[model samples]
Target: MNAIIHILQTQSNGILEALGQHISISLISLFIAAIIAIPLAIILMTHKRIAEIILQITSILQTIPSLALLGILIPFVGIGTIPSIIALVVYAVMPIFQNTYSGLTTIDPNLEEAAEAFGLSRTKKLIKFQLPLAMPMIISGIRIAMVMIIGTATLAALIGAGGLGTYILLGIETNNNALLLIGAILSAILTLIFSALINGISKLSLKKIGILFSVVVVLFGGFAGYRSFVKPTVNVTIAGKMGSEPQILINMYKELIEQDHPNMKVSLKPNFGGTSFLYKALESGSVDIYPEFTGTVLESLVKTNKNVSHNPEKTYQVAKDLLKKQANMEYLKPMQYQNGYDLAVKRSFAKKYNLKTISDLVRVEHRLHAGFDPDFYQQSDGYPGIKKAYGLDLASVKTMEPSIRYKAIANGKVNIVDGYTTDPEIQEYDLVALKDDKNHFPPYQGAPLMTEKFAMKHPEIKTTLNKLSGKITTADMQKMNYLVTVKHEKASKVAHDYLVSKKLLK
Candidate 1:
């Protein structure tokens, strides 16, 4: 409880900012859904067959997984608030459409008939009679949709749309229960607040409702216009993939760049997703820069089948050349750390099995229960490479999120897990990284990556970033990761301290 309070007090500003974003996104998505669905429901009233078809399509859309829908939309719409809102709106439409249609169709037929008998036109009858009678049901649907949107909007954080989910994802990645609780609690509160507000709106007369909606629309539109037209002093967006390392590294990037160019503003999207998401964001111009691993650049981004030399410099050179040639992205000089993949086991377990190398795992392979990150489990250069090089195949392997695997290994839920060489959990959990005796894994030096066009446009920024080249050693990174993940220290502070210690920041 004290920890939670301390965190809340320390991060109050960030929490409020995320809350505001969450509310904005949820309301906008709900508003858009209402505009599209309510009107369509009205139109479909006279055409039952068409209404059924449209409602069915919307139901199908709702069934599409949220993350999958977001991924599908990324290339077309890019990341951040737009894609997040679109995905939420997709989920919001079905309930609103269905409920409105049903409410109108099922309204006391007598009332509708009387409105017609009184010489009312179709549009007049809809406005003066049918809509008012069906108000309760329509409000109910909106309420349901609002609640769902508020909950799901948390995922917007995954694609760099700021929200409480930032705290949630950070908590999960760092094993901070307090942070997780804060995000979940806040989201639940927001849902309740919106649900109650919708219920209040339901009680208003139709004319009042229309007036309220008009006011809201105007406010929303004006805010959107202001953001679109108003430029920041000098804005540069930097994003990072999930994990403490990326979060810390991106903070370092932000601090360094801002120190060099005080007039410049840096927007950070930390724990923004995995490699593919960040790369796509960069490609789409949604993000200006991000930290990336040299090995990942070669293996995942470039997707080259050519062999990469084991030496760090050679691997970095190959990745740098390929990224520039194929993707038109500039790879900056990397820090002096090889955060490559390694298989680790509890130190006691390794000692018991006398496992000193990847080959040594062969003896215990049949008995080992291994947990791996999803990417490592599927990538050829990951598990497949280990299988081929060491001829060790674990009988039990479970693919899980990167953060979960650490807990799994610590709890003895799994005896072995795939981990990065510099992962803090290795030290936290007393795990031993077996030697890749056959050099199955390539060196993975971390570096800032940006499009060539952006690099050319801001040569000074490039110079500012290059100051970090070959600076952070493997031990330096491991210690910083440990500080953020295990000690629950803020990433920004850790980054700043590291730079100050190295005299890179004044």
Candidate 2:
């Protein structure tokens, strides 16, 4: 009950904004689907062979996974509203097209003959006689399309498109069930409302329906004009990885930036495909800022295998300097703690093997089965490099989801798993993090990375964001992650509370 009130009271603005984007995207897709499908359906009535081919094509599109379709579209069209709408239109077309074809072909032959007896022109016959009778089936098709599109539209958030799905995804990432529930409930409500509107219009008299359609056209035109011409005063977009820590950090930036610069518009685009995705988005101008780690910038972006200085402060400076020279990117002050990747095993397993460090794991590694996230195998500082550095050979390695890795180790599904130092599950599952005795993995102090040009242009924005520097301690991050994943608190509220406690905001 408290969760419900929190969402309603605290997150109301986000809910409305997402709702508008969701409705606008779905409606535009449905409108486009109707325009294309209805005309094609009419043409196909006279050409059955062509109808079969086109129907097969659209049927295949419906079979493509929503996320996969969006991914494929991204490379060609890039991300955001355009690719999302294109994907939604592809998904929506078949239902409306199939229904239109069926409605026209299945029209009563006696009524058609009666219309022909009046010497009706072909165009007039379609508009005056055939279309009116087919309206019900077409409307039914549209209702199905609209509902389906609403659910699928949520996937658009994965590609950085704004919609209600953003809330749901963030909720899941941050372990905020209330935010998740609100996003879901609003999506369902929106779906039902759209379905009801279509049904109501279908039931209206022809003249009344025509009047309503005209009004819709005018309203849509005005909205398009507003979106194109009337821009916000300041737009700052912040993106980050898909986890509670990054979500909290980005939300903090959002709160602080908006509070400090009230006239500036701040947007959160968290849970990107990966760090690489965020990098590309930043480079291409889709985003202005994002939370990153010093070590990740050095290792992944710079592709450096050599370790930097041992001191955290010096290491941060090294990373910052490297970023400035190599990519013209700026690294702001880092958080107080390091969230470096670590290898962990269950407490019992560790005791039995007497494993206190990565080198210790090498002693009994050949007898152990290892589990790691896919990124571990792909990254330079991940499993393969770690194994090479430590000269260890495990019996087997399996790729697993990050969230399930802790349970896998605890349940003995895998004897060892890769983890982060700040992961809350480590304490919960009673696992032990193996020390990096060989110092193979570099330090990963979290910070915000942006283009130097952007920083120079918006100096105050940098100052507002840097308020988070050295603020979140290691224990603080673990506690926040635990609160979201274990306690089910909202990420936004968690961030807000933390800022208030720090007096970063009032």
Candidate 3:
């Protein structure tokens, strides 16, 4: 119950922000669709054959997938919210166009006769009688389009367009169930509220259904208006590791600023890269701040994860020294979580060949199937080196996304799978992970890296992020990740709830 309250308090602002973006995309597209559709409908009324052909063309456009549409548009239009608006507008055209035409055509024959008998001009009859009568139907069509777009616009986050979908996508990727559940709950609520608002508008304007819609356009003219024109405003970018865990952490940082450090301007960019790539971005200053595993930095960055001196303190020290000297980066405090690499297998397979470590696979590796993400399969620290170090020769290896590979293993398509130690599915799927007794891989401990420039601008950014370092135990992270990816929650809620539950923030 404490966890639930913490989530609502922390993520409510982000949910509102996402709602704003979702509504902006939906309303703008709907408005544009009405402009295009209404005219087309009027022309179709005048020229029936041409309208049929135009409607058929729009029908075909509606069949394409939203993701696919975004993909096609990305190469030409590039990224951000603009491309999202265009795709949604295209999607909206068919419904709005059809409804407008139907409403106009279905007007009472007697009304037309009355207009004609009154000796009104064609334009006058159309505007005074036909248009007013069609208002309710037109509004209904727009309402349907609005609802459809609200749901579909959730897809906008895929191409870096900010919306509630950002949380949803990342939650699924990392297997964080809390993140998934909270995201769903918030998105559902927003849709229902927006639907109610629009319906209220229809009732009030159309004047028959006894519904009243009072729309208040709280226009935040721009970012300048949202922000105070005071001195000492700080700009900070906090990037998370790709998927839900990172997204959640970033959102937590944002909430912290809003709650305690309103003078600071916090901008979050989640899913920067895998643990290793984020290190590169940090070193190069392309990214200002990012979350990472401590063991990962110790091994991949400092090259210090070894069979000897594998303790956490020594690992953190070695990594800290390396970052200070070579990368011009600083670590504030470690996070509560320690996400690490894990290896999984079916319960039957682990028992069958006595597979307990990297070395054990050598005995029956010939008959086993191996699976990992395609990128993980080819990395220098991946299977190639594992083969050389442990002599675990497998019969075959397959590559797939981290999401799909677990299913592959569960279905018996593969006997062995690479997994994140913090992933919840490792527990839910009841898979067994072997210990790397030989210490074949390096450690991956998480820390936030901030550029020297960013540190000067926003000191609070480092403090807020670093507060979470070393906070999440392996099991805790695994559970959070499971809720995100497997259960379909939201990342912002996951991070916020986790922090609040742990008393890191109010």
Candidate 4:
């Protein structure tokens, strides 16, 4: 309880910002769904054959996984609030459509006959009688959609559309319980508030619905207008992976860029999936920049795996050349840290086995089980490559989520796990990262990746961002990660303090 209160107090501004985003997107999505579903429902009621087909289509859409829907939309619409809104609207259509059709068709046959006998026009009857009678059912559909959207909108954070989900995603990535709880509770509270409002309005007369809806439109329109008029002159968007290090780097870049150029508005896009989403977004012009590792660029993105060395400078050079030649993206200078994946074990396990390096583990390979993330397990440099390279294999292995890999090893669920050298858990759990004596992994030096077109348009951005190069050392990154992952500190605050200490920002 104290932790929750402290989070609310210290993160009041962020909570409010996320709150506004959450409400705005939810309302907009509900409004859009109503427009699409209500009219389609009315039109389809007359065409029974067509209605069945359309309803089936909408039902199928509702069944599609939310994350999968977002991924499908990202390449077409790119990231941010637009794609998020589109996905939410798709998910929200069914309830509204079904209820609207039910409400209109469920009217008594005698009422239609009486209206025709009284010579009332079709449009007039629909407006003066049918619609008013059906209003309750229509409102109920909207209520259902509003509630669902409130929850679904939380996933928007995965694609960089800010909401309370931002805290939740970041919380899970950094392992911060307080941040996770805050996001979850606030989202529930927002849903309840909107549900109550809809219920109250549903009980009122049709005239009251119109009046309340108009008020909502006016308020939202005014806020939109205010934002448009005050938009910044130069807009720079920075995207990154879901982990703590990427968050730190992107936040650091945002702070530096905004501090150096007050006229520019810098946005941080968080990608919860992986680097592929961001890479495509950058190429497709959805995002302008992101922090990438040299080895990942060369090996994973560039597919230049053979004979890669442990030298950071060589890795950076190779990655820069390949990226520039193939994708027209520029690679900035590398940071003073190597975050390559290494096999790690609890210090006690290493001591008991007398293991100090990758080669040393071969002796105990048959007796030990290993845990690794599925991504690492499947990658070329992962377990498969490791087994072939060293001619050794573990007795058993399990693929698990990256977030739990460290905990799994620490708790004796596995004897070894794949981990980044800079992971804070290494220090927290008193784990020893075995030496890579044969240079099996490429040098994973941190660097900034930006599209050449964006760089040329805003040449100053590259210069400003490159200021981060050679600044964040191994210890610096580990400590910053520890603050967020262990101490529950916000990434922006951690980045800001690091910049102040480096004399890079005021």
Question: lDDT for every model?
Answer: 0.90, 0.84, 0.69, 0.86
lDDT of 2 by residue, 402-447 (tens): 6666667878889889988999888888999999998877788999
Model 2 weakest lDDT span, ten residues long: 302-311
Arranged by lDDT, best first: 1, 4, 2, 3
Clashes of 3: 45
Over 215-241, each residue of candidate 3 has an lDDT whose tens digit, in order, gives 222343343245445534546556676
Question: Who is ahead in TM-score, 2 or 4?
Answer: 4
How many pairs of residues collide in each model? 0, 0, 45, 0
Residue 4 lDDT in candidate 2: 70
Clashing pairs in 4: none
Give the per-residue lDDT of model 1 (tens digit) for 257-352: 988999899999898887778888899888899999888887789968788788899999999999999999999999888899999999999889
lDDT of 3 at 379: 53
Cα deviation of 34 in candidate 2 (Å)?
Answer: 2.0
Each candidate structure's TM-score, on Cα atoms with residue i matched to residue i, is 0.95, 0.79, 0.57, 0.88
In candidate 1, which residue ranges exceed 4 Å CA deviation?
Answer: 223-231
Candidate 3 residue-wise lDDT at 228: 49
- State each model's C-alpha RMSD to the native: 1.9, 4.3, 8.5, 3.2
- Regions of candidate 4 where Cα sits further than 4 Å from its true position: 106-120, 259-263, 270-273, 305-307, 345-378, 387-401, 404-416, 434-438, 500-506
Model 2 misplaced stretches (Cα beyond 4 Å): 9-17, 47-53, 56-64, 68-82, 105-118, 132-137, 159-161, 196-209, 220-232, 255-263, 302-327, 348-374, 383-417, 463-471, 488-506
